[model samples]
Target: MPVGYFVTGTDTGVGKTLTSCALLHAFAMAGKSAIGMKPIAAGCENGKWIDVERLVEASNVPAARELINPYALVQSIAPHIAARQTGIVINIATVQRAFKALQEMAEVVIVEGAGGFLVPLDDRYDSSDLARTLGLPVVLVVGLRLGCLNHALLTARAIHVSGLSLAGWVANQIDPHMESQAENIHTLQHRLNCPLLGVLPFSEKIAAREYASLLDITHL
Candidate 1:
């Protein structure tokens, strides 16, 4: 069976894609064939989702675009709204089928979720539902900024409630100027009940491959 993870964040712009790409590189470093999948994505530039492209670039395993991103909504908005606007239904079955295909193509598949864990995919379902359907361990990316403690704690609780294992979490230092960043990390380490896989420093020009070295994949 392929080892997979559902990557979600505390909130949007919390470095989920960056963490996902770094995981791909880290897995590759560990001599495992790995590919990254977005399943569903909102926002596109020049007819491409930037997150999908970044994942592809970081991946060592070659996969078809369709399997990597089953639903690539053009608008940069909430996925449910984007889908509704484009008359596209966000189907979990379709995503599952694509995920299975990716599983066959790699030893590890990193499935990156859109927005937060409970962001609605459709009126009837949300990202948490998709993670449950995938049945993969999740890796939460807690963006280190103001109000991180509440967001991280709430997200962790939700993951547990959803019956998914939070394999580990990455602390991406998104705000270089945030006060007491180390204290914040220390608090989460004690409270989250999971290993701290990595603490990524803020860097505007660092590549994912470089960031991969900072992550400890052993926790996952």
Candidate 2:
């Protein structure tokens, strides 16, 4: 059976891609064939999305580009806005079909959601709705910094409210200078009601493969 997770962040620029790649590497390390999916990628350069490229690089299995990233929009902004500018309708069903196809090729699939948990996909559907539609357990990437407490709590609450399991969370230390980092993590561990999968400290450079070894996949 194909099994995996939906990786979402508390907010954008929170290392969702890094976490996704790390998860993929973790699965690969476990001797499982894994692939990464970016259902909706808004940022594009030249012709391809930077994040999707990185995801493909980290996966252990090969999947069709269209299936791996169904919606690769041109503009680097909100998904809904990018869809509008490109005259494309971001359909949940299309993404679902793509996910199903990817499942045929790999034992584990990591689907990375765009932006925050509640970010809009279209006027009618957001990332939350997409997660509900997919029915996958969620792994949140909490960017450790000021105001993370509120963002992480709100995102976790929304995930639960939407009727999905908060499988676990990754603490990505985005701000090296942020005060009371350990206390912040302690507070989240007490309140989030899920496993703290790993704590990623701030690094000037990140190699996803190297970072993958740091994450424990037992809870995942």
Candidate 3:
């Protein structure tokens, strides 16, 4: 059977891409062939998708551009809006097809979701829908900050309601000076029904390969 995870976040800019890259690096360190899939990305610069490029760079397993990211929207905005502006209809079936192909090529495929768990891909489908379609366990990226507790709980609730398992969660310290960080993690540890994978300290630079060692892949 194919093994993989759907990496989602409590909200946007919560280090979802960073965590996904870390997973790829972690699996690589363990001698497992790993690949990262973006599926849908909003932002683009010079006709290149930054998140997709980052995932491709981090992955040990090489995959086709279309397979790694099926939807590369031009605008750096909500996926639905970007799609509409570019006359693109975000298709879940296309993403599913790409995922199946990736599964055949790699031992582990880490799929990174765009924006938040409930962000809409189109008028009908959202990130939650895509995660369910892939049937992969979810690893949430919680940006530790003032409103993290609420966002984390709500995102966890949505994942469960979608009938998918919350495999584990990572607390990315996006806020370096956030008060009582330990207490916040403790609260999430108590509230969430899954294991606390790891807590990453805030870093000015993205040391994904270094941070990869910090992730507890055993839980994954």
Candidate 4:
């Protein structure tokens, strides 16, 4: 059986890709054939692409970019807006196909959603919808900031409403200036019904590899 997970964030720029890559690396380090999927990517680099390129870089080289990021939008906006701009119809079927195909090649798969759980990809599809389609447990990336409690709670509720389980969560402290950050972590640990796989500090100097102890790769 292919072991897989869905990675969503409190919002865009919450280091979902970075966390996803770290999980991939963890699985690789554990001698498992790990793979990653972006499903959709926003924001572009160079003249041609998006964050999926970075995912491709971190993933096992054998998995093609097309396999990881099935949809790469050049426009840096909500996925629905990006889809409309490109006249692309983003939906569950397309993403599900990409996900299923990727599973055929690797034992462990990480599917990273483009933005927040409710950010629309189309009229009827969103990150939650895709996660439901994948039918895997979720690993939410909580961008530790002031309003994270609300965002994380809302996302957790939505995940529950979608009839799926949140496998675990990672707290990436994006706001170094956030006051009483430890309090927020304590609150989340008390409220969230899942494991806190990590509590990452805000740092420009710490490489992803240094935080290996922070992650719980046992689920992989």
Candidate 5:
């Protein structure tokens, strides 16, 4: 079976794409063929989703665009709203098919979730539902900031409730000025029942490959 992971976050703008790309790079560094997938994306620039493009660039295994992003909604809004506006239905089956296709093309596929873990993809299914459908272990990205303790713990609980494994987590230092960040991370390390993959320092200009070294893919 192909190894894979579903990457989700505590909330939006929590560096899901960055972490996904870093995972792709990390797997590649480990001599494993890896690719990244964004099953549903809401935003686009110049008729292309930047996150999807970044994933493609970071991947060691080449894959078709359709397989990488099955639902490329044009609007920069919630996925369900974007799908409705575009007269598209976010179908989990379609995404599952694409994920299976990507699985065949690489040894490891890092599937990135839209928005948060529970963000709605359609009327009946949210991102967590989609993650459950894929049946891959999840890597939660906790953006190191205020209220992260609550967000991370709640998300971890939700993942357990969803019948999925919280394989690991990444602490992306998104807030440089936030005081007592170490204490927050230490608290989460003791609370969350998973390995701390890495502590990514805050950097605006660093590439995902640079961040790859910070991540200990061994736990993954």
Candidate 6:
């Protein structure tokens, strides 16, 4: 079976991309052929999708960029709005086809989601709907900071309601000075049934592949 995980976050700007990239680098370092996908990306600059470009670079195989990110919108907004801006409709089946193509050449595929679990993709399609269509387990990236307790549990609850397994979680320290960091971890460690895969410290001077060293993949 292809080793894969649908990477989601507690909320937007919660280091989901960083964790997804780390998984790609970690698996590659462990001698596994890894590939990653953003599938649907928002935030295009000058008509270029930056996040999609990043995932293209992270892949260990020779998959085409179009297969990695089949849906790209030019507006830097919610996917539904972004797709609507250009009269483009985001299709879940197209993304699934892209994923199937990527799987033929990689041992592990890490798929990163845009924004949050409930972010809308089209008139009726959301990230949660796409996750269900893919039928892959999830690895949530929890942004460790204030209000995280509520966000983490709520996201965990949402994932459960989505009917996918929460394979594990990564606690990303985006705010270094956030209060009671230890307690937050303890709370999540207790409330979340998945394993605490790793805890990353805040860093302003590190790249994703470099910051990936902090993760203990054995726990994953």
Which numbered prediction scores highest in lDDT against the true structure? 1
58-169 in candidate 4: lDDT tens per residue?
Answer: 6774776677777878888998998898898876787788788888888889888888988888887677888888899999999998899999999999999999999999
Q: Can you write out model 5's per-residue Cα lDDT over 1-220, one digit (the tens) per residue?
A: 7999999999999899999999999999999999999999889899889999999999998888999999998899999999998899888999999999999999999999999999998788899999999999999999999999999999999999999999999999999999999999999999999999998888887489999988999997
Superposed by TM-score, candidate 4 places the C-alpha of residue 190 at a distance from the truth, in angstroms, of 0.9
RMSD (Å) per prediction: 0.7, 0.7, 0.8, 1.6, 0.7, 1.3
Query: How many clashes in each candidate?
Result: 0, 0, 0, 0, 0, 0
Clashing residue pairs in candidate 2 are: none
Cα error of candidate 5 at position 145, Å: 0.9
Residue 187, candidate 1: Cα error in Å is 0.1
TM-score, cand. 2 vs. native:
0.98
Over 1-220, each residue of candidate 6 has an lDDT whose tens digit, in order, gives 7878899998888898888888888888889899999888888787778776666676677788788888877777888997887998889999999988888889898999999888998888799999999998989899988888898899889999989899899999999999999889998999999998888789885367875676777765
Off by over 4 Å in 1: none
Cα miss at 201, model 3 (Å)?
Answer: 1.2
lDDT computed for candidate 6? 0.86
Question: What overall lDDT, based on C-alpha atoms, would model 2 receive against the true structure?
Answer: 0.94
Lowest-lDDT window of 10 residues in candidate 4? 205-214
Which segments of model 3 are wrong by more than 4 Å? Answer: none
C-alpha lDDT (0 to 100) for residue 99 of candidate 6: 88
What's model 6's TM-score? 0.95
RMSD of 2: 0.7
How do the predictions measure up, each by TM-score?
0.99, 0.98, 0.98, 0.94, 0.98, 0.95
Model 4 misplaced regions, further than 4 Å: 48-50
